[model samples]
Target: MELHELESAWKTLDAQVAQQDVELKQLRTQNLRMRMRGKLMRASFGQWAQLGIGLLFALWGGSYWFDHLGTPHLVAYGLAVHAYGIALLATAVVMLLHLAAVDYAQPVADVQQRLLTLRRTRIRSERVCWIVGAVVWVPIMMIALRTIGLDAWLANPAWVLGNLAAAVAIAAAAAWVMWRRPAWFAKLSMDGPLAEVERQLADISELRA
Candidate 1:
């Protein structure tokens, strides 16, 4: 759907998140263990979903990568095809978040210490991404620079830049998704009540503070 529509859907969920917050507080007072377990379930569920998404995309991307362009595809063509891999790879990344705004409402389904724990875990995941970028992306970047050099790479570096740019955009979008609906980020990227979900998520967050 369109961005604004996504935002609106997100808003509805945001309200739910706030409502969940109150429910969680009540659960804490009513059933401490259930509340904690609920959090654990939510966290585990999110991670599992994200792992599945990433694996699916990467595998699909790999298939697309080796799917074959033609009887004699050049390196450029290969790279272009591989750009799909990058996009899929980006989709696979699951930001550490446990909000149920997107996840439970439509198809699937967290708590406070649980929220905090999930947040901490999410932070670590981002760090891991950063680390992975350094270990994997940097070497490739250096090679890119060497091959294309300062001038050539700079001039119409669409091939090199497209992957990086897509990655950056995906990362930013994923980050936002995680904050608002970690489960949604894990399950789906392009869709997932983004418009309403975002609006609700914003309101939920605002309500919290």
Candidate 2:
């Protein structure tokens, strides 16, 4: 072959190879995005389920509180439960909003940042709910007893007080533990879908780099 013709052929091959590389990267990115979409869908479903449950709790608590409006202790118990339900609803809403805010079309770094924010919010909310649940159960139990036609507080004020004290102690201890050893709880938070998404994002970023 002529030298000039040979050089032209070589340049054509190089261009083809570069095009294939671009196409391959695009394919890999698309596949990663599909996987990420599936993960986000699953996470969204979970949040929707939580939202439904929160709504149910709020409805029940609201009705209970309304019914016991004339009784101070029962009203207090009902209000506490109602507030817990509201908190749950709020958490669900916030999480769903964060999920919605995640734009897959953006760069991987941006998506990862949003996912991390969601994960952080989720972990903090879960911690709050776990600690508060310890004390919230007292009110729940009181409401349950009331449902069965028993005024627990009136029948055994000392018992009720004791239970309240124990719950407070438990909640306080849990809070202290979480505050002192945050890394322990952080490990626990690293298992969810958001964490998985973050991991995959890191891998994708590394591959692209």
Each prediction's Cα lDDT score? 0.46, 0.85
Assess candidate 2 and give its TM-score to the true structure.
0.90
State which candidate has the highest TM-score: 2
Q: Count the backbone clashes (under 3 Å) in each candidate.
A: 26, 0
Model 1, range 1-209, lDDT digits (tens) per residue?
99999999999999999899888754543443334335545555655675665555446434543654452322333343344435434433433334432232221113334344445445555544543343335324533464455433445556656766766776566566667875654434312332233333334444445
Off by over 4 Å in 2: 2-7
Superposed Cα deviation of residue 161, candidate 2 (Å)? 1.8
Q: lDDT for model 2, on a 0 to 1 scale?
A: 0.85
lDDT of 2 by residue, 1-209 (tens): 99999999999999999999989988888888888888888888888987887788788888888998898888788788788888788988998999999998999888888988987888888787777789889999988887799989999999999999999999999888889998887767656676677777877897689
C-alpha lDDT of residue 153 in model 2: 91
